[model samples]
Target: MSHWLPASPCTPPGCAVHAGPARRPVPAAALLLAGCALTLAGVLCAPLALSLTGGARRERLVRCWAHAVLRVFGVGVRITGPPAVRGGAAGGRAGTPGVLVVANHVSWLDIPLVAAVCPGRMLAKSDIRRWPVLGPLAALGGTLFVERERLRSLPATVRSLASALHGGARVVVFPEGSTWCGRGPGGRFRPAAFQAAIDAGAAVQPLRIRYLGGPPDHRAPAGAAAFVGDDPLAASLWRVVRAAGLTAEIRVLAPIPAGAVPGRRELARLAQSTVASDSANLPAASVHH
Candidate 1:
């Protein structure tokens, strides 16, 4: 593996444990079909939606589709946060500048979860542009692809992100650089993406994403939803389909003003620590281990 590609010690074998029993094959199969149909609908409609709409209309379209996708997979969503106000007095910076939405990398589901709330340009690894169905959808959504394996491409990527932010675009990024099982230790947030916020004078919106539901304890990670290590996308999809009552809870913490910290490293650390501390404070029964 390349040194630049972020990795986690959490592996498929170690994290496949589920919070609840699997759905019977018949029901799971039906859900799989419905999810596939919904996804295809999104791919076909996305271009037309983008061509005809802008601003809030486009956001609603994306958010509704993402919510439907999560529902089809039997994954519920619960969001808690201060509402984003104009000039971001409540959530972000004190200007009309764009907001940088950053979140923990957990599963492929994380993509839709983020979009369900903050619909905007996403910073994704270049390889996602080649995935079968998701690739087209992501492209249509204005994803900014990055060559994570190439150290030389870092500056260019940062510049592109800054340009987007400068244009008053809310850009979503997963700074872990890779996915991890939603349970154990997650990879630390990489500092590279934070540079764009610094350059654009944007507000940083840190989000904490956790997969909840299992036995009464509800402390275990939803292994079925994790897309980490060598787990294939198809396998992960099936696992999610078969899981019963899985929930993805999103917490949008207060946004840090642009230049709140001196450098990208400090900014990244601030965001990471914020997410970690929030997770630590959740009720022990609801917290993921």
Candidate 2:
């Protein structure tokens, strides 16, 4: 086991209160089991609720599940800017037509993190649709799956996304194409999906998700999938939950008018720059054990 001291009592310029080192009292095995059980139960229940209910009720159930998972894992999430707006007056009436959100790729938790806050449909990789438990759960949540290898299918995917936007359903896309762990930027943003926002004439909302602590060196532990690897889902999650409290700064950058940029590339660039700039300013969370 490792011993960590509270951040030095002396305050420094531009420094936030440092969190004391957390000790894992509960047995890792036990915590893992409990977390896995809760996650599986939640995943199983979500699909049934979606099938029986329509409209906001179904979404609320999913959001509840997301919150439940976070609570069970003892994770904390903090948002920095405005809350997300859903369709119509119920979602704070940002507008009825709905908005398209573009966010950076980080961990798999990004799904539930955004879902818990915004309550929007997600655009996920085709592989997720085939996962054991999560696949079905996400499908029930109305997540849009895209095949990255099939360039020909891109148009159809964009059209579906556009239609969803016009129908008053909020949609989220991670344009980084893949996930990465090192400091600085990871993958380049893929512009194809931005076409959906332009075609639908919807405002493009940019969001940035940054993890404060959790693995190897405390950086956003690789991507969520890798972090969860061969270990039981519950165990992997507990490792993160016990490692450190996670702080996510979700900034809703000013809405960019659809088609304001002549092409998807321009839209992607603008969104990427906005997210990168905002992430750079957040306080660094300790990764060293």
lDDT per residue for candidate 2 within 49-80, as digits (tens), equals: 75788667766776677766665555566666
Q: Whole-model lDDT for model 1 versus the true structure?
A: 0.81
Q: Give the TM-score of candidate 1.
A: 0.91
Q: Candidate 1 has which clashing residue pairs, if any?
A: 19-214
- Candidate 2 Cα deviation (angstroms), residue 80: 1.6
- Across 156-240, the per-residue lDDT of candidate 1 in tens digits comes to 9999988888777888999998887766446788888899999988889888898877765554557778787888888888889
* C-alpha RMSD of candidate 2: 9.4
Q: Model 1, which residues run further than 4 Å from truth? A: 1-3, 84-95, 215-220, 282-289
Q: Local distance difference test, per candidate?
A: 0.81, 0.62
Candidate 2: residue 107 lDDT (0-100) = 57
- Clashing residue pairs in candidate 2 are 217-287, 218-287
TM-score to true structure, per model: 0.91, 0.75
Please state every model's RMSD to the true fold in angstroms.
Answer: 3.2, 9.4
